[model samples]
Target: MPDAPPSAAPVEESTEDWRRRNVGRLLNEAVRRFESRVLERLAEQGFHGVRLAHVGVTRNLDVAGTRPTELAYRASMTKQAMGELIGQCVDLGLVRREPDPADGRAKIVRFTDQGLHFLEHFRRAVVAAQGEMGENLGEERVRALLETLWDYVHPDGT
Candidate 1:
């Protein structure tokens, strides 16, 4: 007899297996979970205005302050997008813009006292989140994961 035709239906992948095996998805889920914990803690501490979207710029911000262009570049965003986020931060009284000493036409964004307070809260929340992650994943695994991520992010130690 002649060979029958092949099946037309595509093979399906198990969602659980995919979730467990995809490195990008795993990393993204981990980040989401961590950010959720941090934001929840921030909310508990009365930092109600901060949102997940704000984190892209806020977390990348330099402690000594930086220009909008630089912040935008670091956050992998455009200057206009960074400017909008900065305006929101200004309205929230978290940051303020001052003329840059090195360049008269450019402005540097610096955290206000209120912003400093928020940063302290964020630091605490991050520590708490890390502790929780360690409790769930075990200390050694968590440390290894962090070290691996650090190496991935800074390949040449730069």
Candidate 2:
């Protein structure tokens, strides 16, 4: 293969230049775009207006079937807000609250069979959306980038 001319070479960026460029802001914009794309695709797949926050709660429920208080802590949400959201999910038949064995005072929120089915559909939509993005950058690079961001976001452990 023939080497490219020097005039076409990649630009060398100084640390100071990169710092002044607001890279974090840029990354935040990229994330927003990614999220918008995913939501659009989900709608196209018949899940209109299904906010990503709902998926977060489902993901949390899957990992830890906990009381509302514990879920709020894990999800970094205010208890009142979590309760409201969980109530909405319950109304939608996306989740259920069962009496907590450890603490009868609190009910553990869990995914119902319907919620599990919806979660699976959500997973497929997310996977397809990510795969579409990965077509441009490759899946490995996207995965590594996400992992690196997670490391910074949850430095203490999530």
Candidate 3:
């Protein structure tokens, strides 16, 4: 093989320094912790069926409604996977698939009345979770971090 590129140097051993707790690991751990807290709050609100996986659908759901394919795209999932999740949500009475008016063959997934209520509860749960994070990281730091992440993720203002 030819020589490796300048940026392709072999990774060093993980010591007691930052290598052991790299950015990706730190971010993933923090997100899991945050999601766990949010799920706990949801459970407290009697939405025990809601899990972290459900967030992938709810987070990307449009206010009016959305197609399963669109939700899959937004959630970085496949249509089949999203369809299964949609079925699960429907079973839980969190959403319903209605015939799309614009396209007779297409279906639009919209939150049910129960789901609308759950959305309000979910919002409050998120606020409570953020409060907990703020308590740990200080209000300013947490908000700043959220702002940075929001900007980074929604660069197109979607």
C-alpha local distance difference test of each model? 0.85, 0.75, 0.86
List of clashing residue pairs for candidate 1 = none
Alpha-carbon deviation at 123 in model 1, angstroms:
0.5
Give candidate 3's total backbone clashes: 0
lDDT of 3 by residue, 1-158 (tens): 95332233435555343443565666798889988998998898899998887878888888799999999999998999999998988988999999999999999999999999989988998899889999998999998998988898899977
Task: Compare candidates 1 and 3 on TM-score and give the better one.
Answer: 1
Q: lDDT order of candidates, best first?
A: 3, 1, 2
Candidate 1 Cα misplacement greater than 4 A, ranges: 1-20
User: After TM-score superposition, what is the CA distance of residue 109 in candidate 1 from its true location, in Å?
Assistant: 0.2
Q: Where's the lowest-lDDT run of ten residues in candidate 1? A: 3-12
* Model 2 CA RMSD to the hidden true structure, in angstroms: 6.3
Candidate 2: the clashing residue pairs are none
- What C-alpha RMSD separates each model from the true structure? 8.3, 6.3, 7.2
Candidate 1, residue 145: lDDT: 91
Candidate 2 — which residues are off by over 4 angstroms? 1-21, 150-158
Provide the global lDDT of candidate 1 against the true structure. Answer: 0.85
